[model samples]
Target chain A: EAEVAQSPRYKITEKSQAVAFWCDPISGHATLYWYRQILGQGPELLVQFQDESVVDDSQLPKDRFSAERLKGVDSTLKIQPAELGDSAMYLCASSSRLSYNEQFFGPGTRLTVL
Target chain B: SQQGEEDPQALSIQEGENATMNCSYKTSINNLQWYRQNSGRGLVHLILIRSNEREKHSGRLRVTLDTSKKSSSLLITASRAADTASYFCATVSDRGSTLGRLYFGRGTQLTVWP
Candidate 1:
């Protein structure tokens, strides 16, 4: 079975530093999602993309967080001046359609900010 | 303000026993989904119950949805040690600007001891 791919399975960084995570969705998936999961809490959506255009990013902290899916196949999420509260598991998911029918998630990139 | 909230934050069961988790949501949803996550890993999709559907089953997992009550339940029958994980309930609203967006709950931690 094809799976979503994520890089930097673990990231440790100091507060106020910049960090980025990468994700590659399944080959034919057209919708990609970025989520942040805090300890003991379910994941929250940070951004959603349809092809190369962003469909929703209402919860994303626009001032510090940014995500882009340039070619629509892979995506990158960057945080400038990371904060201690930003430490969490970054998850990426993909689906054949834009709906939340059945999403396939990656192994995730665990970010720890000190 | 969370759309979905799961009950019994933690549960413990012996191998070969059954486990049940309940989820309640605050809004009308188009579909509800159940996901499982192992420690320090990403989530895996389990079962999805549509708003119009009352019950769904996949292998040993059974999911039931009550749109009138806005609640859902997941039952894992004849569970094994490998079934131990955090289970989350996610919903996609039928009415919203981000129609396809998913709202996830805090999840229930289940431990199945062999």
Candidate 2:
């Protein structure tokens, strides 16, 4: 089975710095999602993309965070001037359609803002 | 808050025993899904149950949804050491949104001893 792919399994950066995470959804998957998971808590949606357009980014912090899927195949999420609370597991997931569906996930990128 | 809540934050059992985790959500949902994550890794899709469905089974995993109660349960039977992981319940709401999203619960951590 084809799975989503993410880069930089682990990242350690100091506060006030910049960092980015990347994700490539499964082939032919129409929907892609980015989530943030804090320790001992459930994952939280950061953004959602359909094809090459962003469908939802209500949860994304516009002041310091931005995400784009220009071609709709791969995406990049960036955070500038990171804060201590920004340390968490960044996850990428993909699904076939908008209807009731199961999502495929990647290994994730662990971001630690020191 | 669109987040869901999961019961039994933690559980421990011997190998071959059955583990059960329950999830409750506040809003109407199109479907409910179960996922597993090992430590800091990304989520792994387990099973999905549609709102119209009562129960569904896959291998040793069984999922049941009660729309009336706004609750769902996941059962892992004949568990093994590899089954020791954090289980989360996610829901896709019936309402329309900018982008389709899945809201996850806090999750239940299960430890299966051999």
Candidate 3:
């Protein structure tokens, strides 16, 4: 029953504003991920972290988006100057390297950019 | 740039019936995983098949992976109305820096009627 945790389950902001989402993964999970799910579409990886170090962030829009896992446990994703298209569900996932590659996902933070 | 593409965008079935979904990937994968998401909620990991595994079973769910064909199938037998959700397939690549990065498909919307 160790579930990934997310905060501020819902967020609404105007375009050009700043928004941030937080996620706490399962205990001892070494890999953490941030994903964005547009309405009616699957989640897409925005950034991945392995023990506080970024592993893959090719799909991340570095100009306006940033993510971090400072302690290698909990992570934060921020969208600065949020655009209308940034409205989506932001999800966090984690999996331990010692376990099978099955990821546990958090309830997610739904962002609405008006 | 999704690595997996799930077949049949939507499926409707009666309770107790079997539900099967297929996913095709574009590259060699270290593993393929299936996840379910209820409306407005986070994803729940359903099953994962590694590159070396062909088939796996958990309760009423049976997952088959054809690594040669870069495809995987998830079959849920004796489904219930609660099984109504969006199901997605995610792929982890065999290449560098992609082991923990999951590329996901658009997902299939399943509506199981009671």
Candidate 4:
């Protein structure tokens, strides 16, 4: 069904370690989004990309988190020196510019920091 | 900070019963979208209602938006066990520079017992 693809459905790491999650959006989608969902809470936007360019990242914690969509098709989100509070489900979503109303989400990478 | 908040954090109902969830947002939005996520799974887009549109329906799902009150509601008629999931409301703000960025609510967890 042309779903967004995410790798390493689950990840566990030490608090001070580094971790990365990858996502490949649906083909021809121009807008990509990264969101973080804490247990019992709604997902929050971490970053947004438009054709390889960042459109919004105000909510992203730049001191420890970084995200990139170099080709505008696939994206990578990284957290260096991860914290225990960072444990959550990292989600990726994409939508076509023509029909920006609906977003297709990936299975997500559940990150657990010890 | 999340832009929307959903009512009734959790709901339990029998199969074939109708389920309703409500959402309220803090700002003017271009559109409001509803999504469902099963346990440990990705989100599935259900329906989207534009700010100008008051109501929309898809199969057993119906959504209504009240722009004046900055609120929306989702009603699922003839619910089944398979309909058990967490439902979330996402809004695209009209004041944002990007048109596709979504701000989500905490979500409503629904359980449909057979």
Pairs of colliding residues, candidate 1: none
lDDT of 4 by residue, A1-114 (tens): 799999889999999999999999999999999999999888888999998999899989999999999888899999998999999999999999898778899999999999
Q: Give one digit per residue, the lDDT tens place, for model 1 in A44-95.
A: 9999999999999989999999999998899999999899999999999999
lDDT (tens digit, per residue) of candidate 4 on B1-114:
437899999999999999999999988888999999999888999998999999999999999999999999999999999999999999988885577788889899999999
Query: Order of candidates by TM-score, top first?
Result: 4, 1, 2, 3
For all candidates, state DockQ relative to the true structure.
Answer: 0.82, 0.73, 0.79, 0.89
Chain B TM-score, model 4, reads 0.97
Clash pairs detected, candidate 3: none
CAPRI-wise, candidate 1 is high
Stretches of candidate 4 above 4 Å error? none
How far off is model 4, as Cα RMSD? 1.0
Which of the two, 3 or 4, has more lDDT?
Answer: 4
Cand. 1: chain B TM-score: 0.96
State the DockQ, from 0 to 1, for candidate 1. Answer: 0.82
| lDDT (CA) per prediction | 0.93, 0.91, 0.91, 0.93
lDDT, candidate 2, at A113 = 91
Residues B1-106 of candidate 1 have per-residue lDDT tens digits of 5468998899999999999999999988889999999999999989888899999999999999988988999999999999999999999888865646778999
In the order shown, what is each candidate's alpha-carbon RMSD?
1.2, 1.3, 1.3, 1.0
| Model 3 lDDT per residue over A32-85, tens place | 989999998899989999999998898999999999999999999999999999
Best by DockQ: 4
C-alpha lDDT of residue B39 in model 4: 93
- Sorting all predicted structures by lDDT, with the top scorer first, yields 4, 1, 3, 2
